[model samples]
Target: MHVEEVFVKARFFRALVVAVSALASSAGFAGEVQVAVAANFTAPVQAIAADFEKDTGNKVVASFGATGQFYAQIKNGAPFEVFLAADDSTPAKLETEGMTVRGSRFTYATGALALWSAKDGYVDSNGDVLKKNEFTHLAIANPKTAPYGLAATQALDKLGLAQAVAPKIVEGQNISQAQQFIATGNAELGFVALSQIYKNGKITSGSAWIVPASLHEPIKQDAVILNKGKDNPVAKQFIDYLKGPKAAAVIKSYGYQL
Candidate 1:
């Protein structure tokens, strides 16, 4: 009888130990945060996520796409905890609709537009390349969906080159796809995010004219904690970390203007 009682107690204690261990593992996994990011900001955000993970000891998984698409997904119940948008408008709309934490939004970066070509010596720095009509296909993101595309159109319009360049334009669904068009030679030249061209702290194998901000409306990128992230401690920390100097340095290194 004594032996049986001891065995029963041992079994119960072992089960308790296993339960506690499982809880601990679950807590550790919950510390990771998922982020939805605008495609144009992918490069910089990837660098920032690395720094954020190092600083906070938390994991960050980012999905890149057009802001408009992300907005739709979040509304339909995506599991993303944070959103980094290519423009302020969408974030503002999310806030107004109470889909994000109140007052948790801020502009993280100002994006720059660039005319890029994979072929060396193809792009002219003086912005006259468009005037020459030398390229048969020019790529731009879908203006109706991507903020960068709208900025590109505004720039062309401001320069009085819109009509001249319209026929040559090939539209990609997002900035990253547009970059692929130029990078893969599907298009001779494309308007891409400056972050794509400025790799490793320098322009990579392309001549580009960084379109002046005056030529178009500002491309103010904003970050917000989604309503889904309200209960997530790690998500809140990651959002705050993006405003810190560590993340700022990484963002600037990718040619984003903070």
Candidate 2:
């Protein structure tokens, strides 16, 4: 009789442990949110996510891509709960299409454009760098897909160098890729996001000049919670965290204007 009682108790304990483990797993699943982010905002978004995770105990899984690509994915039923776009157009279109929750969109940051070169003594801040014919290759994002590339084109045109530099230009699919082309020395110079070179309150290495805003239309980045995320408390919390002071500090540190 005693042996039979011991077996029953053991079985009961095993069942209890299994039930508790399942509950823990469910809770963890509830605490995660997925985000679609723009490549230009990658650095700041990472910093913001770290703070958000600490404060809310929620995990954010972010996918970075060009704003237009992200918009297409969201329309095709991508699982993202929120989007941080490189410009206002994508988010606004999502709103019009009812892909995003109405009134859930807001301007998150203003991006800065730069003429950057990884090689020393290659870029001049006074806008005279293009006057020289020494560079063999120049890089910019595909203007049709990437907002930064369009801004770069505008800046070149305003400086009267577009016609001269067009033949030398190599285009990347996105701003981050454009940065990579220059960073890897595949291209001698490129127009890229200022955030890539600015970190920890300074421009550490490489040479760049922040292009004047007057050279192009403003790059106003926007963020939105998708309609699919409307009822997700974790998604709402993440959005709030982005608008909080901690995220703002990170954004400013990365050479973005909030």
Candidate number achieving the greatest TM-score relative to the actual structure: 2
lDDT of candidate 1 over 1-258, digit per residue (tens):
699999999999999999999999976675788899999888788887887777767889999999998999999999999999999999999999989998899999998899889988888887788889888999999998899999999999998999998988999999999999999999999899998889757797767878888988999999999999999998889988999898888788878888
Task: Pick out the ten consecutive residues of candidate 2 with the lowest summed lDDT.
Answer: 125-134
TM-score of 1: 0.89
Tens digits of per-residue lDDT, candidate 2, 120-236, equal 778988757877857889999888878899999999989889999888999988888999999999998889999988987666678888899999999999999998899889888
What are the clash counts of all predictions, listed in order? 0, 0
Error of 1 at 150 (Å): 0.4
Pairs of residues at least 3 apart in sequence or in different chains that clash in candidate 2: none
TM-scores, each model vs. reference: 0.89, 0.90
The local distance difference test score of each candidate is 0.90, 0.89
- lDDT value for model 1: 0.90
